[model samples]
Structure formats: C-alpha cells, structure tokens
Target: MNVSLILIILLIGALATYMVGDKFASKIALLFGLVSLGASILLLNHYNLGENIGLFTQWIAKPNISFALQADGLALAMLLLTTALTPIIIFSSFGTEVKNAKTFYALILFMAFAMAGTFLAADGLLYYIFWELALLPIYFIALVWGNGDAEERKKAVVKFFIYTLAGSLFMLIGFVYLYQKAGSLLIEDLYQLNLNGTEQIWLFAAFFLAYAIKIPIIPFHTWQASVYQKAPTVGTMLLSGIMLKMGLYSVIRWQLPIVPFAAKAHVTIMLVLGIAGVVYGSIVALKQKDLKKLLAYSSLAHVGLIAAGAYTLTTDGMSGAVLQMIAHGFVVVGLFFAAEIIFRRYDTRTIADMGGIRSQAPKFTSLFLILVLASVALPGTFNFVGEFTVLYSLSQVNMGFAIVGGTTIILGAYYMLKMFQSVMLGETNAKPFADVTANEGIVLVVIISVLFFFGLYPKPIVELIAPSIEEIVNQINRIK
Candidate 1:
C-alpha cells in the first residue's frame, strides 16, 4: 500500500462519518481510525522490506510544487502515532455526551487526516498547507464544542487561532523566499540551496517563530493554558497529543537542515529557550488550581525539553525527541483523560474540590498513578527512556543545559503527585466517584501497556528512528 492510502482512508472516513449522521458517527470514526492504523502498519512493513510506499507526482507545474509524500522511518513513526491515537481519542469519548456528534467525530478524523498529511508531505508547500489545515478542525472543535463561559472560551480560542495562524504566516513567507531561491518547494530541492549566512539567519528565525509558537515553547506559550482549559477534552487531547508534535517534527524535517549554518551558530540560544520553557512551565504548573491548565503547563514543560533535544543537533538528541514525542502523546492523552474522568464524576476540575477518590475507585487510582509516574519519567516507564536520552544529549552539549533541563523530571513529579494526592487521596468525597468503566479502563490499560512495553524494550523505536535522525544530523552539519 502506498503512503497516500492512509490519508485517503482518513479523508474518506471523515466524510463518511459525517454523512452517516450522529448515531453511527462515533463508531464509524473509530472503525476508520482502526483501519488507518492498520494501513499504517502495512505501510511500515513494506517500508521495512525496503519497498517504496511514498507518492510523488506533479501538482502545480508553474510553481514546481509536486504532490509528494515521503514515508521514511521517521515519517512512518509519526504517522503511526497519529493513527494509533485517533482511535483511542475517539474511544475515550464514547460514553461522554457530545453535541453535534457527527460534526465532532468527523472533525476529529479530518484533523487526523491533516496531521498525517503534515507528517508525510515532502513538498514544502504541501506540508505548509497540511499544517494549516490541521488548525481548522481544532479551532471549530474548541470554539463550538468547548466548555467555560462563552465569551471566555471565545477569547481563549481566538487568541490561540490568531497566535498560531500569525506565526505560521511567517513560516509561509520563509517558504516563499526559499522557493524563489531554489526554484522549487520540494524538501530535497530546498535542502540543496546553498544560501549564505545572512539568508540562513533570516530563514531560521522565520521558521523558528512558527515552530516555537506551535510547540508553544516558553515566551511563545501564553495562549496554551487558557486554550487547553477551555477546549473540549477531545479537542485538548488532539492539540496536546498530536498537534504539538507537528512543530517539533518540523524542526528536524524542515528548519535545521535547510539552515544548518544558522542552526549551528544559534544552538546555545535554542538550548536556553528550550530549558527556560522547561523551568518556566514546570514552575507555573505547580500553581495551577485547574487540572487541565496544570496539565497544559506541564505539557509546555515536556515539549520544551523535547524541543531542546531537537535543537542539540545530535543524533541521540533528535531521536530522543522523536521517541519522547510518541511517549508524551500517549501519556498526556491519558493524563487529560484522567482529568476528564474526574470532571465527569465530580463535575469539577478544581484541585481544591476533589479528594479521596482512591477509596472509591482503586482501578482508576492505580491507572492514574501509573500514568503520573510515567509522566515523571520513572525508571521503568517509557518516558524515562526518552527523558534520559534527551538529558544525556544535552549533557554532551553542556552540563549546565542538562542540569536545568533535568529539572522537568523532579518538578513534574512534585506537581503531578501533589495533584494526585489532592484529587485522589485523603477523605472520600461524599459524592460518588465511580471506578473507571470498562471502556475507560481499556483506554488507560492500552496507554500504560505501551509505556511499560516500550520502556523495557525501546530498541525497536530507537532502531527505527536512528537512521532517519542520523541523516538529518548529517544534513545539519554539512556546509556547502
């Protein structure tokens, strides 16, 4: 199967799910999500056998843009993340009530399609288009379906929409300039453009602005916590889980390689910004009373470290970023789902209002505790493997960078455990807090399983991403 089939499956699924109406939309979305996951698996197998599954054909002859989709190991790994999580995200919403269920489910599938395209598109313009398209579904999902006061939700969502859209325009300008110099917008062509130091610096800033805002690294992260708190749980999941990775992935795939000299020159600044986000995010997370907002800041901190690793310009750093990207996706989704679970039962997200859930729901407490431990990168969980590798890569750059970046683990454990104790421990709430239903249990089980399984046996992921990351590192260090 060609890589394009995955996109086609999701697009068709989106349309079909919408047309089938609300009653069947969720099931259909889940089915299509599973099918797409299966398709990605088949493509991965073909890719492993060294069969070409990517698509490349002429699109707009005038602009020299082609409809290209490349499925190297790195892209496929991301595609797998997108597909695997789509179903889980959908399934997580199964028992929850949703307004305009058809539109909601369809949008989720479409967002999946857009995110997959973003990962696979090899043409710079195509990738940009996919990147922006991913925003639309989430915007509507947050604005229309989100919670909180109407005006407040609007303010938050609009700020997010404007911040991301504005940042992306800078990136588009950079791509336009690159197209002028290279005579093509294909990624391979862009990489070969031997631009001077001045040009590289400009292009680097443009792309970095876009990525930093999307990755929502510190300073550029003002829009994050409010939006995360306001958006529906599913929308929050899509944003935190998959959409954030789009920016980090682009740094490796687009930014660093095309502007190697500038990237190399500015490594220290990048590392500082990344670690700053780590510290800043973690500290802010400590003060959050709202569970989702706390997790939002927590996400900011985690991605900050991931971005730091990507900026380190080493193979270990890049691979660790990718591995952590996948791990963070699952863990964050589970954590947010846990928040949703609490919100569902107690009808409150305030940490102050929650208490003593362990007495009522052992299964939920156990799973949530495990997820919390994974978030802190406990030694045996998948998060540890990624966090440790990222830290080691930082150390190779500078011990100071590693030391500051490592604060994420310690600070994360502190706030997450504190939140858990407040929400799940102490005197039992007079209101009933049920154990996780079978569906909820299944979702948490699946997430924890991936964490532990990969934690112990990360060789598969490490091996899969190594060659691709090595190529990017070579490209970054190669000077014309």
Candidate 2:
C-alpha cells in the first residue's frame, strides 16, 4: 500500500469511531490507532526497499495544485512519530472521565490524519491544507473538553486559534506568490525558482512568520502556556507530543529549502531568537506554580533549541533537530501523562497542592523520576543524544551560541528536579496516593523503554534520517 493508506486508515478510523457510538469509541479508536501504526511500519519497510510509496496526481489543475504525498526517510520518520504516539495518547485517556467519548476519540483520530498528511504532502498548497486542517480538531478538543473556567478556556482556545490561523494566512500568501512565479505549487518547482535576494527574504519572512508563531518562538508564544493549562491532558499530549513537530518539520521540509538565501543570511538572527526562547522558556518554567504550565514552558525551551539547530544549516544541526523532535515527542507525552496521573488522584494541577507521593507509590515515583531525568538530558537518555548534538552544531556556528544554548540543560535539570521534588517527594500528603494501574504502568514502561533503547542505540534512526538531512544541507549550500 502507498503512504496514503496511513492517512486513509486514520480517516476511516475517525468515521468508524464516531459511528460506533461512545461505548465502543475508545476501543475502536485505539484499534485504528494501532492499525495505522502498523501501516506506517509497512510503508517504512517498503520505502527502505526503495519501493515508491508516494502519490502524485492532479487535484486542482487551475491553480496548478496536485494531490501529492512524498515518502522519504524524513517524512516517514515523522509519520511514525504521529502514528506511534497516537495510540498511546488514546490509551492514556482511558483513565480519565471523558464526556462524549465518541466525539473525543473521533477528533483525536482526525487530528492524527491531518498531521500525517501534513508530513507527507509535497505539493505546497496541499501541504498547507493539511497544515490548516490539523488545527481544527485541536481547537475543538481544547475548547469543549478542556478544563478550567468556561469563559477563560474559551478565551485561550480562541486566541490560539486566531494566532495560528492568522500566521497561516501569511504562509498561504507566500505559497500563492510562489505559484504565480513558478507556475506550480509543487515543492520541487518552488525550489527551482531563481528568486533574487529580495524575493527570497520576503518569502522567507512570510513563511517564518507562520512557523515562528506555530513554533511559538519568543513574543509569539503568549498563547501556549494558557492553552496548555486549559486543555485536557489528552489534548495537551496531542499538542505537545505531535502537533508542535508540524512546525519544526515544516522548517526542514518547506521553509529552509525553498528560501536558502534568506535562511543562510539570517542564520544568526534565527539562532539568537531561538536561543532567547531557550533561556526565557527555561527561566519561566522554573517559576511556574502550576504543573502543566511548567511543562508547557519546558516544551517552549526544548523546541527553541530544536529550531536553533535547524537554522544552523549544517547536517549535524538538522540531524540533531530531527532526533530531538522525535525524542521530545515521546518525552513530552510521558511527562504530560505523569501530570495527568497526579491530577487524576489529587484533582489539582497546582504544585503546592502536591507532595510526597513517593512515599505511597514507589513505582510511579521511579517512572516519573526517569522521565524527569530524561527531560534534563541525562547522559544515558535519548534526550542527551539530541541535545548534545544540537549544542555541538551551535558551537560549530559560534562558541557563544553553544554556551548560551547549553543553559537549557543546566536550567532544565534544576527546574525539572525541583518540580519533581515538590510534586513527587517531601512530606506525605494525608491523601493516599496509589501506584499506577496496569494501563498506566504499560504506558510509562513503553515510553521509558523507547527512550533508553534509542539512547543507547540510535544508529538505525540516525541512518534512516541521515540521507534526508544531507539533502537539506545540500539544498542550503546550493545558495552559493
């Protein structure tokens, strides 16, 4: 089957889950989630064997857009991340009380479908459609199912919607301009256009505006922590675990390659912005009193570094960004899940309301500790591999950049460990804290296993994505 099967499966899953009703919605959703993951694996195998799994065909001939999906090591790696985390995200919801399970599960599957399409679509307009489509389900997920005051949650969700949609309009404008000049919205065609410095800079800014907001770098990040605090844990997981990667993936896939001149010239500016977010996010995270909000800022910090690595325009930088994207995807999901676990028992997201759970639940405490350590990029965890490489890439650009970016590690450790101590340790609360249930244990174990396995042996992943990273670097170098 072609790569489209993965998308088709998720689409069908959404419909089927909705039709099957609430009683069976979660089950069907999980089943479909697993099946989609299997399809992605099969497609990956076919791709490895050099079989063509991509689809390119006419969709709208008038505007020169086509229904195109490209499958390469890089795209498949992202597809795998989307598919793999979906089931875990779905299963993670089983512990919580979900009103209107059918709608909730269906939206999750549909979001997966859109995200998977975003990664695979090669035609520029088609890619934009998928990119925009991914935002809808999350908006509703956070708005309707999200916690907190109704008016406040509505405000946060609406702001997030407007911010992302507004940013995407600029991107849509860029694509239109590219299509006008190149006579096609296909990525390869856009890459071939002989744009001068001015055109390249403008287009890059347009696309960067969209990506920067979605990646929520610095000033544009005002919406993130509130939404993360308001959204349901499952919604938060989907956003942190998979959706943010869409922006990072687009930087590697569309932005840098299409406007190498601007990317090259502004590398320092981008690096500075990214490093600034790293510092700002880390310090803010240290001061957060709410657990989810702390994790949200931490996400901002990690993604800022990833963005910096991508802008470095070196193979090592791009590769590290990809690795970190995958590593962050899993780790953030696990960390959010841990927060949800605590909330499930204590009914609070405030750090002050939590303490000494370690006394009651050793298993939960140990798992949470490992995730915290992983977040800090301990030497043996998968995060270290990605973070170290990113720092190395920054050092290649400028020693000062590396030194500044490296603060994420030290600051990340201090804040995360501090959060852990406050939430998971200290005097035992009078409230009894039970260890994780079988389902919860399974989720944590599965996540930890992947982190440790990849930490020790990342060769397969590194090799899978190496050629693609090399191609991107080659594209950047072609500017000369």
Task: For each candidate in the order shown, give its overall lDDT on alpha carbons.
Answer: 0.95, 0.94
Clashes of each: 0, 1
| Candidate 2 lDDT by residue in tens digits, 1-480 | 677899999999999999999999999999999999999999988988888778999999797789999988999999999999999999999998788999999999999999999999999989999999999999999999999999999999999999999999999999999999999998888878888999999999999989998887887899999999999999999999999999999999999999999999999999999999999999999999999999999999999999999999999999999999999999999999999999999989999989999989999999999999999899888999999999999999999999999999999999999999999888888789999999999999999999999999989899889988898888878988
For model 1, what is the error of residue 82's alpha carbon versus the real structure, in angstroms, after optimal superposition? 0.3
Candidate 2 ranges beyond 4 A from true positions: none
What does candidate 1's lDDT look like per residue over 247-320, in tens digits? 99999999999999999999999999999999999999999999999999999999999999999999989999
Q: Which 10 consecutive residues of model 1 have the lowest summed lDDT? A: 45-54
lDDT of 1: 0.95
**Residue 301 displacement (Å), model 2:** 0.6
